[model samples]
Target: MRKLPAGRAGVAPAPLPEESASRPLHSVSGTPSPLPPAPRELTVRALVMGGLIGSVLAVTNVYMGLKTGLWESGCVLSSLLAFGGLSVLARRGAPPSPLETNLAQTTAVSVGAMPASAGLLGAVPALTLLGTQPPGWAVALWGVGLGTLGVLFAFSLRRRLLEEEALPFPTGAAAAELISTLHSTGSAYAARARGLWTSGLVSGVLTWLRDASQLVPPVSLLPAAMRVGGMGPETLSLGMAWNPMLLGIGVLVGLQAGLSILLGSLVAWLGLAPWLVREGVATGATPDALRESLAAWLLWPGVGLMVGAAATSIASQVRALPAVLADLRGLARYGEGWEATASRWVARAVLPVILLTGAMGWFAFHLSPLYFLLALVLAVPLCAVCARATGQTDIAPISPVGQFAQGAFGMLAPPLPSLNASAGAVVSGAASHASGSLWSLQAGRLLGTSASRQLLVQLSGLLLGAAVALPTYHLLVSVHGLDSQALPVPTGRQFKAVAELLTARGLEGLPRSSTLATGVAFALGVVLSAAARGRLARLLPSAAAMGLGFLLPASYAVTLCLGTLLAALVGRLRPSTTQTVQSAGAGAIVGESLVGVFVSALSLMRQG
Candidate 1:
């Protein structure tokens, strides 16, 4: 067996040979190692770890949804912190095998859905609006059902997406780096875990205070009209706000992306929104109404154009698919052999356990079994298509497949109540998330971990997430009255309102400033792609997405962008420390979000 450089743990020192490298490290040696053991009290430990981390994730998810109208990033960021911290702490006694590292990375990232999977909370407003709430068993069953559905959907797509089409699992990459660094440096996981806990707690407290009252002060200093001035007859606007975490996101995204997002916001708020307001097409002061009106007139066309560009660009890369698939096939065959030979059975056991858990969830919950089955079936094809569409031929499109499966389920079940739809949405979120976890696992596979062990750890985290998060959702909803018709959670309300407006207004011959902005931004992105060339250009889509995020509200965008810039500046100043800086920033985001969620949960607990 080829050995990596001494003391350089967690890093993939070099890509392994075609056959031997692809097999699990333990399996290749023909020595059956016992299952890779976790702490003695593994189940209890996992639950405790999950509960703490899950609580934090829940809060951050809600805060982000309420604050920026996005939930994915916050969840992703929090999961990174949890897993990264764990990996860092685990390095003390014996270096975690690649399998263990992969497991931890996968588990942490998988558990990230805590916030977005607000099962019952999501159903509450819609149920109330419809004047119905399911029985407790029904709700629990729903949670189990949707969670199972998500697993099935994610699993079906896993092979094709994770193995064949190499997607840029960005968050996974970050997690891998953290794990590698900690092990290499011989650091204790306990210290890192403590850091995560402390940071998370602080973040949670601050976020809670901000949401609880007016004491934090609104970040927007500009009046509505001033922000909306210029950019045609539409209402264009901007504002300045303070949010450390969002700012960090902006910085990490970089100036170009941040600026692009700002431009998107300018088009929507400054140009289109004001026009609608003045024309009496929308009511001022109602951001949700404005967003819907703008989305109707501008957002869809912009989305179409962007999709067109991505499709065109990606189609050019389709020739690489065959090669990528061959690579994955080779890995799968090798992995099978490793499982047969390796004694480290724990990791190998993960695949079956995950599958079993998913099946159990399906039966326990009353979701349509067909949807769950279909999700699995469609995953590979969808991932392949998305990979082809996005020109990411080297990286498997596992994440996209997961996302599409969930999205498809949601679409199919749309007429159902919000809670049910939310369940579907959770499926999508979790599946999309699994893509990243799979990516981490693949990374470990390259570095000599057994596939079975990696799979086990990842599943451990996923189950942990489900176990802790569902209750947290109920607690938050009950305490905060999120399910109340009078005070629906911000994101759900916004989504509902937008859907309503689209239904009422229809999409025809409407003025679309956001669409125009998107058009211009996309053109600019293409130029950026040309200028950046190679690896840099790969970030174009993310940059464009960031721009779109920014174009929402100036105050929000500005703060986020600034935070991102600060992080970037640190990266530039200490080029060698980019990963650490990123980890710290991500930790802060998770911390703040967790604090907010815990507070909300606590409030609910107290009220109950």
Candidate 2:
């Protein structure tokens, strides 16, 4: 599984243009496919394993996203784990085939993405913050509908993105490489597999000690009373979070993104927040409530920056749309009727899902018929942009899709937060699932697996993921609530802040200083995002990441930045061990997250 990088929601970097052309898939042993073609791709065992892995990941994602605003699509992880587990059973007459692995991976990734696709981690939580709670089943159905819509879109664009243009979806490519390596004779996977499980075990044990057993005390880098110029470190929220997942995400996202968050955190916590409190523009009744109080003011500018940055990134991605559309036209000839080929089946699957989504939106979310329908319509183009961007950079701009939808409905809808938020959810969910599906599809294509079978596996995983995601969300929310410090829900808070900002009577409801800060932040976001698309792209900070820094606890930024530096140091000092670090980091995230969910469930049961 890969977490969303900094600025991932919408401000993913522009695609690299000067890449090599497509080539045939080969094993790490420098040979064509080592495994023979499978008699079946979508076996019952594959579906079961996919669903199991996906369901676990769906729970983990909800916990991770709400706690840290970082979520992953578990394609690579699923591939590795499935291969390792199934290969053991291979000696009993059932061989572990690459195509079957692809099917399992597809199903797992689909299921893993359900939390984001269903808006459980963001939009739904934002709605809850605003006091609107849809029933759990409704949310699950809504997620399923959106996920299905995305899968259909992925099928439509597979030919254009994968078969024709041959964009390198790096994450998918990694999964393919893993499959190939696993299937190769005298494989090098044993070392990696060991590192993965070992790190996972250590992290899980630590999480248990810290959260469940309570034997380990919280670690703070600064004393609460450590002061500079009449301000204390505690007041500024300057501390590092001691969590394995933060370290893992930092390693994955790298230095630039970590520095970007640090930059934003310094600005918000040290600069803007202090000034606001000093000038009485922001207030809290007690010292304990100060951070929360300040966040209410900070998120406006943070969300503004995110929106601006996303807009710029989306604009840059738009240039590829014309070419993508032109290539898509080549799918079916003019002579083909509605019932002629695969396009007909796609249409049949798509139309009813679309209608079902619309119906669900109306009955469950109180979405306006015209507004929500428009959101679904807009998702088509936005999903195209997301697909192209992901293929190019392995970052799906799902947040940007929702941010765009929010902006559109903010103006068109009747200033209702629910209406606009639901619209955003519809668009974001569809785009997220679509991009996720493409990653799976990309892996399938490289392995020469059956696309149709992969599609079915994805749909099956979607249903299972939806079932798992909603209940897990409720469980976490029931234990932590939306406002608890344990689960800061930065993305959800951002969504809530944006909904309120869009619904506000212009700038009338905000402090004058806050309005000014928001304007400056928005402009800076746009300029920074534009700069990131140019020659200094690698050197510059991500505007969206900086914006997230403002929304998250300063400790999160500090810890994640430290992790980034740690990863960099490891890479420079011991290059050969870099992959080991990566595997350990990924394991840590999975380990801690799984334990975190288990602890949450235990806490919930105790409360009952």
lDDT tens digits, residue span 117-181, model 2: 89987899889888898888888888999999888788778877886677778788777766766
> Which candidate gets the maximum lDDT versus the true structure?
2
The models' CA-based lDDT, in order, is: 0.45, 0.78
Steric overlap count per candidate: 57, 2
What is candidate 1's lDDT per residue for 1-608, written digit by digit as tens? Answer: 12222234445633223443345535557996543333221233333443455545545555554445444433234334444544445567443343344444445545554344333323333334444444544444333334433333333334455455544344444444555555556553445455445544665555655766546753545664444433222223245554555754564555665665665555555655666666665543565455545544544433333333443444454575665455334433333444434223432443563464345335433335555455444433444444333223223322223323333554555444332433333333433444444544445434455444444444455555555555655555566555231122433433332223233333333344334544565565455534444676544544334434532445666676676677677877978655555555556666665655666666665666
- Residue 543 error, candidate 2, Å: 0.9
Candidate 1 local accuracy as lDDT? Answer: 0.45
